[model samples]
Structures are given as C-alpha cells and as structure tokens.
Target: MKRESRQTTGGQAWVVNRKKEDKKMEPKWLTERRQKAAEDFKTLPLPKTDEFWRRTNLSRIPFDQFEPIQSVTNGAAKGSASRYLPVPMMVSGELLYGEKMSPATLDPNSQKAGVILDGLQNALEKYPELVLKYFGKGFQNRHEKFLAQNEAFWQTGVFCYIPKNTQVELPILLASHFSGGNQSAAPRLLIVLDKGAKTTIVHYASSETENDSIFLNNVVEIYIEEEAHLTYIDSQALSDQTFEIAQKRIELETNAKLKWVLDIQGSKLSKTNIETVLKGSGAAAEVLGLLCGNKKQHLELYAWTQHAAPHTTADILIKGTANDAAKTIFQGMIRIEKAAQGTESYMANNNLVLSEKAHADSIPRLEIEADDVRASHGATIGQVDAEQLFYLETRGLNREEAEHLIVEGFYEDIFGRIPVESVREVMRKNIEKKVGVIA
Candidate 1:
C-alpha cells in the first residue's frame, strides 16, 4: 500500500490523517473550511452501547487507532476496472483506469444543460456552490463515531451534477482498488442530481495486493432532486484479509425513483449500510443484495427506508449463503411517518446455510405512525431440503451433486431478478463456491 501523499495525475498530493482545521499553512482558505469540519467532528460522539448495535460486536472493529489513507503514485500498481454489466462502461469515451485518470468525461447534451462530472477535489474548488449545497446535508451523523471520523478525515471523492430534465444514458463506474500497507482509508463519494434528472452509478472496490490490510472506512452519499430517477449498483470484492465499513445515503424528492443492488463477496469483516429517505410524495425505492461468507468471515448488512411523504413506496430483497464457520447478519427497517399516508413498503431476507458450523441472523423492523399505510416483512433461514436432495440422488446423482443442484435452484429465483448480467454471473459463481460446487 502506498502512502497518502503519493503523486498522481495532477500536481495535487493525497491527504492522510489531515484535518480541515489543522493550523498547517498549506492554504488558508481550505484550511479554514477543514478546521470547521474537524470541529464539528470533535463535537460528535461515537456509537456506544445501543439498541441499534445490539446484534453487532462493535469491539471487533479497530476504532481507537484511526489512521489516514496512503496515496498511490504508482498507477501501474492499481488493477484494471471491471463492470458486471452488459452495458458498455466507460468514462469520457475511454475505458476506466485505462490510463492515469485526469478528468472525467461528460456527455455533450449534459454539458450543454450545465451538468458537470469531475474529480471531487477539483470540483470542490470549481463548483463550490453546488458542493456546499448538498455535501453532508442529507447524511447527518447522530453521534456515530464512524460517521464523524469520516467527516473529519475524508478528502478525495467524486462530484456529479445533473441539470433539470437531462438524462445520462450510460451508467458511471467509480471503481478504485487500494492495496493496504499499514494505514486505513476513509473514502468519500458524493453524488447530486438536480430536479427532473436521471442517471445510474456503479462503484467498485478493489485492491492492488492481497496483503493483510486493516480498514477501508468508506462513505457514499447521493442527493436526488424532485422527479429524478437514480439507479446505483455497488460491487465490493476486496481482499479477504481486509475490513470494510461502508455507508450509502439516498435522498429522493417527490415522484423520484431509486433502484439499488449490492454484491459483496470479500473482506473478513464487512459492514455495509444503505438507506433511502423518501422526501417526496409518490417517491419509490427498490433494493436487492447478494453476499457470501466463508472461513470465519463476518458479513453484515443494514438497509433502511424512511417514508417522509404520502404515497411513497419501497421494496427490498437480500439473499446470501454461508459456508464453513462464516457468519452473516441481515437487518432491515421500514419507517412511515405520521404524514406518510397511503405508504407501501415490503421487505424479505432469505439465507442458505451450506455447513452445520455456519451461522446467520435476520432482523426486519417496521415503525409506522400512519395507520393508513401498508407495511410488511418476511425472513427465512434453513438448510437444503433433504427430500429434494434424495429425489435428485435417486436420479443417478451423488449426494453432493444433488445438494448443489438444489442450492442453485434456490438462488436462481433471486439471481434472475438481477438487472446486471455481469453482476449476476459473479454472484452465481460466488454462490457455487460457497456450496463447494465451483472452484
């Protein structure tokens, strides 16, 4: 892993453990802003013993020793970007990370409508107006240590702008792989869509080397304006020895549409949280996730849907498999405010245990203040049906082959729903490995 100050495309250097408020004489203007943010972070409290964290063993996370992320000057050390999608993936007409990245490409029509897509650090200086308007506004940290920690430390990120009535045909991929040395990375990603705009986002996580990395403290925030349509697909396949804590927030205005899918199959300790705030009437959100854990790995996921407006709708499905001594937790929530009349929401979680030693938990919650709203949730945990396995074995298949066929059939239902073919294939292969069917 490279140090935080490693050189990259521009003359700019990466930051590590650098705060917004430090008295360093780097740049007075930026220093002042950084200082303010640091002050705010200091005032926030870390998450302690709480109902929300009851199921999670927070002590396992290395919270006390927080370090800055080292930068990568050796672009050749980084791996090529991958997209699990049929749609062609590129940034500014060139394959992503094909060469050293300088500036992102923007569509001509989007450019004509004042849409902007640029590096986060560069955009902070170029379009301060829009950055200041949406950054950290929708994602308010309520004394959470990780959120506050990210707010103080994160420096580099992405900035996207979409003007009214504009639509981006292709999805944008923000894929970066960090091979860790001895430091931690606090990656920050910010996205904004103006009213009546539409776009898709794909963010991937990778590593340069398969070293015993520490932490990838990452955060991503999305702000969708009124009537906007947003689709976000995230894939994380970091090194198995690493630990990752990721958070994604989505804000939707009236009649806005949000679709999200997550495929995670790496890291020894991985915790991912994705939330959607429906702030507009008739707003809708859909989420689907696939994860696999094996060999003492621990995977946790939290998905939340907040209905702040009337007639909002939401649907969520999360499926995964655990083998060996691997463990996984699936927690989901749906909240309907008093004013959110006629809201509709549904959630479901299904898990397949491949080994007797494997463990998994599912928790679904609903908080409703509107009696007129409709909300429901369901969760199931079980092993492969032995009767079905027996039927397959009688057809000249071995016990192992029979079980494999049953497990594949079980996952086919959810995998068929996956919109991205590349992602679907990745999930299929991962699931097969979990069942010891595929190498």
Candidate 2:
C-alpha cells in the first residue's frame, strides 16, 4: 500500500492518517490546492438564510461539539481476516473493494485486470493530470457552501480508473465509515472509464461506532467516455445519530450508459443530491431509489438530469415509506436544452404514509427548450390499501401479519430488481425492523 500525506508541526495531518515508515510527501500543486480549499472553507459560512433551507431546519447542527480523528480508525469486526466485509451487493456490479482501514488493500484480481484503484492522495501523486482534469467539472465550489467546505476539508477519497475495453469478473466494493474517534468526515470519489470500458461498482457505507452524534459530508463524480457503461449502487445503513449530506453527479459521452440505485435506510437526518448530464448523442441513464424512515428521522432526496445532446434519454423512479413521526422529501427535475432534439425523459415519486403524523413531500419540475422532446413528471402519496389489508386478515394472517404482507408486496418489485440475493435478504430484514412489519 502506497501512502501519501503532508505532516505539520502538530505531528499529524488534518485529513487521513499514515504510518511513519510509509509516508509519501505531498506534491506542491496538491499542497497548494489543500491550502486554498481550507481558506475557502473558512471564508464561506454555512447557508442558513438561503431559500433552500426553508423546508428543512438546519439550526440543530452542533458545530463545536465534535473533533477530527487524530489516529487511524478501523471498525472491522474482530476475528475477520480481511479488514472489510460485504455490505451492499445486489445492485453493486462485479468486484467488491472496500476502504475499510487503509486505502492500499485493493483487490488483487482487480489490480491484475488493469484497474487502477487507490486512495485519492496516492492517486494524486501518481496521476496528477487525470485527477486534476476531472476533480470538479460541472459543479463548482461557489455553487454550494457545503460543497466548498467539503472540498477544503476532504482528506480521504478513492480514485478508480478502468482501462478501455476491460471487464472484471467480480464486483468492486467502495466503502467508508465514520468511527467514534472521527465525528466529522469529508470524503470524495472520482471515477473515470475510458472509451469502450465496462464496469459495475457497489458503494457501501456504515458507521464504525454503533451510535454517535456526528456529521458527514461526501461527494462523488463519475466520467464515462464514449461507448462505456457504468453501473453504480449507493447503499448505506449509517447510525441514526449521524447527519449525512452527500452529492453524486455523472457525465456521459456519446453511446455511454449508466445505471444508478440508492438504498437509504438509516441516519437521523440526511440530504442527498444525485444528478446526471447526458453530454453525447445516444447516451442513456437510469435511476432508482428506495428508503424507509421511522421515529424522528428526516430524509430529503434530490435528482436532476440534463439532456445536452440530441437523442439523449433519462428515466428516474423513487419509492419511500415514512412511519412514526418521521418525514421524507423527494424533488426531481429534468431539463431539455434547445439543441437536444429527440430527447426523452420521465420522472416519478411514490411515497407511503404509515402514520398520521408522518409527512411525505414530492416536487417534480421540468424545463424544456427543445421543440422535439417527450417528458413528464408525477407523484403520489397515500396510506396502505384498506382492501388489501381486509383481504389478508380475512384469510389466516393477523393485523400485523396482514400489514407486513402488504408492505412487502409494495416493495417486491424494487427488491426483486436487485441482482444479489444476500443483499436483498439484508434489505428485507432492515425494512421489516424499521417498519415494524417483520419483527
């Protein structure tokens, strides 16, 4: 494992930790970038007065309560030989690699397949041109305050580059965790697939400690070249005490294809943004998300797609359930530029309100500047079907059992679409526990 870092007189780096014997000095350009980002973070304050903050309350953040990690922290369970374990598998395609403890523990098979996978710092030292070219493409620091803060403080990230026309047989896993020692985290990921390359990645995230009141900020960017295909699945079950703010965006070239799935079943409060830009003709994208929130947990999700070239296509669907006093929000938008003739796009959000006090909000918007395009958006919010429950109870099941079957049937289609069985089982178990159906 190659390690690269910058040490201060305080005897540590503010971002990721490294051993004394394996330290690789930081490059001049990277050091300068880090310094500038830190300065930007200090100058840019959190957005408290913005119109975006109107729906959700941001006043509860404890800015001064937690501190950064001083040493290496790994939450791998005891007796496990590998530092990492498989968490989210179904939607994640071939090759499972995790950033459990150190960034160097890449899959040997993937390395042999000409897949370049390593920590962001290590990759920065080895591939400066590629890293710098796509670090922050469509989104700029000035576009969002939290994004700027993340750019400044981000110490740990992954860089994955797949050579042209190469296929790995196993699923690759990308994982991150917020341990007890590290209450606040900022991590980013950059993925680049050369022309004709095809790969699938399963993104899994969790908390090291069982439960801790912490904050997390994460960002990911993917660049797909012409004729390439990328399948990415974001599945995380973090502790309920954590506040998660994450964004993921993608850019696709001519003939490129992308499949994205998100399963958010944990966290006390979270706000997520996922966007895609079809920059080439014949490029296509698919997005799916499933989430469950209970008690006082709150979740807000955003998705946007832009058709910048003729013949581009995008499809999006999201389903969620809110129980107890929990709440959920989903907002989706589609944009067809004037030059993007023959573009096709559609979006929908469906939510299940299990409790009278729970609330679900859905907003779908579209901006069309193209004369030849097909686009539409829709949303629905309702309670469990009383007829279904009555039919189930009339048979052999009890009230709880009947409700459980109804809810299970509702998510059956989405769960069935996941490719892995073990992951599907785990997700089913979690949904049961969260919604009090399969206890």
Candidate 3:
C-alpha cells in the first residue's frame, strides 16, 4: 500500500484528521481536550512583533517548507529500537495514538502506585478525566501561528499521571523521534500530579534522520497539584538542518514544588517558551536553562513566572555559550499579582561568547502588583574571563584547554541542578562536544 504524503504547510489537517480518528477511537470524556485546543488554535493568531515577541527573530522560520512526520511502518521502528538499545525504557517503540494501537502501553511497574503512564491515546481511553482536567490549564494563549498549529495538529503525545499521595522516585523519560523521509513532526505531552503525589519526568526531542528534515513543532503541558512535587528535565537535539518550535507550561498548586531544566544543543533555528504558574499559597517553582549554539545556529528562549497566590516563590537561571557565528536570545519575565503577597522571585541570565562573530542578548522584566513582594533580575553578556583563563593556563593548560575549563566552570551552577545522574552526565558530554574539549 502506498502511503499518503504529508504537507508541511497544511499540517493542521494532520491533527484534525487525527482528532477525528481519536474521537472514534477514544473515550468520550477525553475528546474535549483536542477539540477545545483545536478551536483555540484556530482563533489565536500567530505572534508577530507582539509584546511577547518583541526581541525575537522570526524572519528565518520556514513554516511552509515543513510537513507532518510520516508513518513509521517502513523499518523505522526496528532501526530506532536498535539505535536506542542502551537507553532505558519499558518500550523503545514509536508513540502512537487513537485506534491505531492500544494507546501505547507503559510498563506495569508504573501502575503499581496507581500511576498511569502512557501515550495520549491511551489516556483518552482510560483516563480521559485526568487528561482533560489539566491540559492547557496553565499555558499562555498568546503566541505565533506555530503555537496554534501545534494545538491543531498535536496528536501523538506522552501522558503521565501520579495518583494521590504516591511517590515515584525513578524518572519517566519521553523521547520524541522525528526522522521522517520528507515530513514535519508534531508531538505533545500532558502530565498530571494528583494531590500529594510526587514524580519526575524527562523529555527528549531529537531527529534521527541524517537528511534535511525541514521542521518539527511540539507542545507539552504539565500540572503539579496540591502538595505534589514534580521535577521536569527537557532536552533538545534536533537535526542541524531543521527548524523547531516548542512550548512548555507548568502549573503549581498550594505547597506544590516544581524543578525544571531546559537544555538545547542542535537545530538551525529554534524558539522555546517555558512558563510556570503559582496558583496556590506557598507554592514554589524553579527554572534552569542551558543552551549551546554553534555553526550559525539561531536560538531563542522565553521563560515566565506568574505568581497568583500568596507567599509563592519562583526563580529562573539561564546560561549558555555561543560560538562560530551562532546567536542566542533569552527573554524572561516575572509577575506578582496583587493577591500574591509576600511573593519572592529572582531572574538571572548569563552568556559566554566564544567567538567575536557570535552574539547573544538577555532581557529580564519584572512586574509586581503587590508592593510587599520581593523581586530581583540580573543579566550578563561577555566573553570568557581572561583572569580565570590565565589562572588555568598557569597550571600547565594550553590556550584551548584553559578557555574550555573556564567556560565549563561558568556553567557548573546549572549543571549541578540536573537531578538524574545519567541526564547530567549526558549534559556534560554534550558540553564537551560543543566546546571541543577533551576529557
């Protein structure tokens, strides 16, 4: 049987078609999430020079030159399994939704604590109420056309739920592979933590295709309920030839805690929107971002913290290095509402420019409607510290070695925050590759 070619510009149809299939294949309670999101996607116009995107560069986005990911019926499954064998997972298979497969099952061990960890399709069939209750509950509605496109077309996704009072020490990993013959990839994630539950999730987005895969767009939604604890680690290594658009939203309830990490290393042009909302008193949220751009890559990251409850605390730290004419932009904002008394939040961003041709910008903003809140913001853009390099060189290090050592130290603060040993080690290895450092 011949497979239908997917259109990049009309990617919305891919999601809409999937929605239809899902409606027939999924439970009735869960259909509302995709339906409402599709409608919201249709109404929300793409952002252009808007307040939120003032410092962003969208001229290089090749929106029309991309298409949805093609079906993996042609040995792609076996190829991926063989490639990722060393990686730990209950199932290294592709993520599927709707009536096509049994909603991509998870390991039975995850179910031992009343947790439901499966793809979106399965959540619809078995835990529709949970998925609908938390989807888009904290994400922003204002964004560019790509965001709407994501809402309209996000069919294949990872879904996880931690039941009340349960604790999951092992982290759950969700990796999205976009290695189509000639197509775009649209993926989504929905995570929920029941009252007093605790869990951690790791999301990895990458392209296995060695060829020119035009584009990949993804959206992820997370909910941390009352007294729940959630730690999320997100990493991206898209093909250097591809374009990427991604959004991540997290909500926190009373006394809930969230630790988030964002890391990026590949892709020609990429934009990320990460945000957290404190909805209950005494809630806490922390965001850490690390980016390395080389070879003319253009990247942008925007992080936001919204404190809507009293005594909430949030902090953000973003660090990155750009080399070989690469460019990076970081814009973050923190808002303390009038009702958010005694709120405290801080935002800091730093960048290391390894080459004169490389460029980076940092914009941090704060809004405090409550006079009793404490907020602070800091930004630094500069080259490596010559004194630090000189000191390292005095210890018998070569010029390249001295420079690499200083840069690595500069990023150690963020590196220290990656909770998982394996992910942290991978982060260090990727850093070494980016800076071409040995050992």
Q: How would you encode candidate 1's per-residue C-alpha lDDT over 295-356 as one tens digit per residue?
A: 88889898888999999999888887787898988999898999999999999899988779
Which lDDT values do the candidates have, in the order given?
0.70, 0.71, 0.72
Instruction: Compose the digit string of candidate 2's lDDT tens values, residues 1-439.
Output: 1111111111123333322312436666655655565555555556657644445565455544455442232334322212233433332122222223454434565567678776676678788888888887757655465676566556567788888887754556666666554366667788988888888776667765554576777788899999999877677777788778888889999999988878887788888888899999999998888878889888888887999999999988888888889899988889899989999998888898877898998888899999999998899998977787789888878877776677677777777667656556666776776765643
Which residue segments of model 1 deviate by more than 4 Å?
1-16, 19-48, 63-67, 70-80, 83-102, 106-114, 208-211, 389-407, 429-439
Q: How high is each candidate's TM-score?
A: 0.84, 0.85, 0.85
Model 3 weakest lDDT span, ten residues long: 1-10
Deviation in Å, model 3, residue 14 alpha carbon: 5.4
lDDT comparison, 1 vs 3, better candidate: 3
| Ranking of all candidate structures by their lDDT, best first | 3, 2, 1
lDDT string for model 3 (2-119, tens) is 1112222334445545544554655554455456656655555456567766555554654445555432222223223213323443332233321122233344655666777666
Error of 2 at 112 (Å): 3.1
Q: What CA RMSD would you report for each candidate?
A: 6.0, 6.4, 5.0
